[model samples]
Target chain A: MREVAVVGVGMTLFGKHTETIRELGEEAVWAALQDAGMSPKDVQVAYAGNALGRISGQEMVSGQMVLREVGITGIPITRIEDACASASFAFRESWLAIASGLYDVAMAVGYEKMTGATTAQIMEALAGASDTELEADLGITFPGVFAMVARRHMYQYGTTREQIAYVSVKNHDNGALNPRSQYQKRFSIEEVLASRPIASPLNLLDCCPISDGCAAAVLVAKDLAPRYTRKPVWVAASGQASGFFEPGSDVTVLKPTIAASQSAYKQAGLGPEDIDLAEVHDCFTIAEVLHTEDLGFAPKGEGGPFIMDGNTAIGGRIPINTSGGLLSKGHPVGATGLAQIVEIVEQLRGQSGHRQVQGARAGLAMCLGGFMHSDAGVVAVHILKA
Target chain B: MPETESTENSRIINEKWFTETPQGKALAGSRCRKCGRTYFPRKRVCVQCFEDGRMEDVALSRMGRLYTFTVAEAGPPGFTLPYAFGYVDLPEGVRVFSPLGGDFARLEIGAEMEMAIGPIRQDDGVDVIGYIFKPV
Candidate 1:
């Protein structure tokens, strides 16, 4: 396959919005095109990631909506939805398309307007990705499932409730530096631990808030690099895996993430030890710790202790979630994956003014999606280099 | 009177109550003849094996382990909160998601459980009889 490099990445601030989903995509795409030193006309093919638009009475094709606005049409545009990893998969697809010589330049963007949906509608849509008979039938919501995992970790690892709140606290610390973060207000551990419980043992702060946002990226061949930007972050490797979807399998750990990450590491010719920084899918506080362990950044069951060591801060051994991750970055499902790419791009490009990881070389981005029946629908990992 | 059907694959679809035979008497399940896979609520076609006909009837074990569980403090508006929910991994190699009855303190893994079905919940003003596990 031909080598692909990310020429530019862009995203909108995460929060409530009056703009339509198409507008969100348009905003990000416009910024990304400007960053790539090109317009919508430069994109030969496009892919957009969106989880729900029809529920709000806007169905049809998503590609046409945004592309039509940008005055670029008649080219291939597809919407991909793999839950939270929706945008990352789109990024992976764009990279492959360019790398395979099928397209010299490609654009991938993810947008989600989740706050528009009512609470019940949101729950049903989220549950639609789960096992119908096993989970949906019993009205088991996503928070309930995540709470199960958090509770299991708490029981097995003796992880206290306060430590769990610290995850949000740490993420918010980074969020405070991030103007784009949703919850920029810093919270204390006691405040988080005292928050009302959404599910048993899972306080409100333990869960990432539903958010609205969009993120986009432009990928092209390394040979065509300097044409778009002077310094392009090289796409070293990409890997993805799916696991069995049954509660019979254990939820204490993520098997798909481990497998996907290993494959990515093998392809990149680098191990987890070489990663200077990372952006993990912390849809929940526990998810960050689990992903850290599953990605081999830490040993088994040592993730809690590893985070407690303060090694994931800006100056730590491997600063993580410099963009505040889903916890503070706001998990607008479709937008989350691409947002991770944007954060890593910003960090690698040395553009992260305050939250930048000094001398960051190679970085890893892990995206996990569709936790159903104890199985993660897809786990995608990408290694980027400066 | 003896039912006289020992084919290990025959059962009436309308049999609301479970049939208890002399030798084997527990909860009966349907087995897909093509793949030999079993399911608690018998169906015409097995989700697996992709084969629809010639499914056999069998009995499931009376006990299972509490795979993973939680006390859901908040659920749907109509549904009551603070209910114990979990999946029971049966000895028959099938995992069943159900509610735990009696006491939450005693809900432990590898606990013996028997199915108790009743109007455990109400939805849209309709009574729904669901299954729950009781420590046996």
Candidate 2:
């Protein structure tokens, strides 16, 4: 396969928005195009990711509808969805299109308009990401599953509840510095622990808020990279994996994340130590701990203490979620994956104002979609280098 | 026929997932004749060995050990708030997900748990009866 480069990336402020999906998509796409110093006509192929548009009333041809707002027409526009990992999968496809020599320039846009839906509607929609026949039908919510995982983690590893709450505190601290973050306020561990309970050991503060937003990126072939931008972030590797249902599998470890991140590390000819920073799927506070361990950033079962030790904080060893992550930045499911990519791109370019990891040469972005049989249904891992 | 009508009215959430054995009511599952692996809620094929047509119906053990659990303070429409649920590891090595139906304070990991049939949630004023686990 040929090499691909991320020439530009952009995202809308992650929070409740009155704007339609089309408007949000247009804002992100146009910003990305302008950042790439290219026009809409330059995009040869396009992929759009929107997870809940159908539930919000845009059922068919959402890609066509969104792209038309930016005057991007008459191209192969495909809509992709894998629950929360929708945008990362779309991004991987865009990179593949260029890497396969099929298209010189490709664009991926992910948008979700969730604020328009009611809370109950949103809960029902999000629950669909799990195994509907077994888990969802049994009235299991995402927080419930993660709470169980947290319990298991604590039982097996002796992880304290305060250690888990520290993740929320650290991410919120970082989010406070990010202009695009949904919640720009930082809270103490006491406040987080005292927040209203959503699940035992996991309060409302530990969970990511429902959000509406969009994120986009432009990719080009290696040969065409210089024409778009001087500081192109090369796509070192892109890895994707699906969950395997094993009844007795360990709940503390995410098998798909390990598989995907290992595949990415191998493809990039690098190890977890080489990663300067990461933007992982922190849909919940406990999730960040699990991802940290699964991605090899920390030893298995020690993710709780690892974060509590200030290892994951900005300016610490291997700063993580510098964009505030899904917890503080808000998780707009479909948009979350590419929104992660947008953060890594900016950090790599040394453009992130306060949350930037200095001299960051390499970064990893990981996103997970759904849960089933005690595992993530899908996971996507991408490595980027300056 | 009268029992069938009563069962229908009872609205046992999923009929295929349970069976009445001489021992008692047990969760109906599938055991792969080739690998000897068992799965709950049954499977058309052995996901592990990918062996098709070598599956046989098996009754799951009614008793298990509480593996992990949590108390969900909120949930979707039908579930009563602050309900408890978890996974139970059975002797057959299959971990089953079930709603816990016992004293909240008595629930603990590694404690003995037994499968019980009861109303899991409400659906349009109807109790959706399904399998649950109670601390023993």
Candidate 3:
């Protein structure tokens, strides 16, 4: 296998976009090309990740549709659908393409347009992320599953609703600094605790908003990366794991995330202690706490205390979700994973203005897709060395 | 099913789910004969030991505690909003997500809970029979 480096990363400002999904894809790709000091002609192959809402399911072969805009039509393109981890998996595949010597340069894009779908349509599309035979049949939604985890964390650890609210409060503050962040507003812990309840412990303020945006990255061989950029974030490790289909795993402890992170750290010859910053999948507030613990930033079941104690704050022991994460950055499903990579790239390059972690040397990002049985259908983790 | 007997009334109907009495009969699941791994909805193969086609039918404990929960401010198609639901970690070590019966606060984490089949909600005039972890 060859050494892999992210030569360039770019994206459109994540928020409600009136532009078509194809246009967003083109914009993101153009930005990446510009960053890479290359053009549409440089990429050898392409992989795109796109998901459909209830009514948005009408569109088929999303990769072919978007790649047409950039005039890279002939290169083999694959459309990925890994729920929220769609683009993350796409990015992973692109990394593999470069690492496995399959391609010297590969284009990875993640695009989604939820502005066109109705609320019901969106919920129905989300249901597709679950097992069609069991959980979805029970009308279970993603928030519903996380909510159960939150409730369990509360009971087992006496983790307060305040700790969950603290996550939103902190992410909002981080999001406030990100110009590309979809959510520009900030929330107080009090505001989160008093917000209208969505399911139970999770309130309206606790949930991430639906977003429409796209992000893209261009990966090249490590030796060739210097030709494009002076600072290419080296891909230290990329690891993925899957979980049980039934809701059997302890929600209080995120097992799949731990295994995936551990595998990634081992592969990279690093540990959680070496990470200076991270962008974890925080689709919900509790998800962030669980992620911190699972990724070995904190001990098992002590995730709540970590948050309450402000250990994950930007200036604290380890800055997390520096891009506002999915909670405040806006979760566009298919594009979220690549978006994390893009943010890490920016932080590494010292391009992130206000949200940047000072002198960050290493970074980690994680994405989980699907929920059933005891596992998150899939877990993807990656480490980057500056 | 009458609304009183049913727990919810969501429109999407799934016939695969059926009511089970905890004390009456054991619900069918799969246990890895070699590795002792268990699966609800039962697996034909053991995932842990990588043993193919070696699972045997086993019964699971119906009792457990409420692990966590959330309410959907927005609901799925054919389902209503503000519904109570969460994951229940059974004594057999299986954590299942199900609707919570009665008040939302009663669905506390670590609260003693047991499985029951009841209406999920009313949808298009049909009551949905879904599983839940009601406070014991």
Query: Which candidate number would show the highest TM-score if scored against the true structure?
Result: 2
lDDT of candidate 3?
0.80
Q: For residues A265-370, what per-residue lDDT tens digits would candidate 3 score against the true structure?
A: 9999999999999889898898898899889999878888897798898887888998898888898877899999999988988888977789998999899888
> Model 2: per-residue lDDT, tens digit, A1-386?
99999998989999999898898999999999999999999999999888887565796789999999999999999999999999999999999999998999999999998887776678778889988878788878888889988988999999999999999999999999999999999999999999999878699998999999999999999988899999999999999999977778898988999999999999999999999999999998999999999999999988988899999999988999999999999988889999999999999999999888999999999999999778899999999999
> How many clashes (backbone N, Cα, C below 3 Å) per candidate?
1, 0, 31
Chain B TM-score for candidate 3? 0.75
Of the two candidates 1 and 2, the one with more favorable lDDT, higher being better, is 2
Ten-residue segment with the worst summed lDDT in candidate 3 chain B? B11-20
Give me the chain B TM-score of candidate 2.
0.90
User: What is the TM-score of each predicted model, taking all chains together?
Assistant: 0.89, 0.97, 0.89
Query: Which lDDT tens digits does candidate 1 get at residues A301-377?
Result: 77777787888878988888988888887988888989999999988989998999999999999998887656787
Question: Order of candidates by lDDT, top first?
Answer: 2, 3, 1
Quality of model 1 by C-alpha lDDT = 0.79
- Best-fitting candidate, scored by lDDT: 2
* Model 3: per-residue Cα lDDT at residue A321: 92
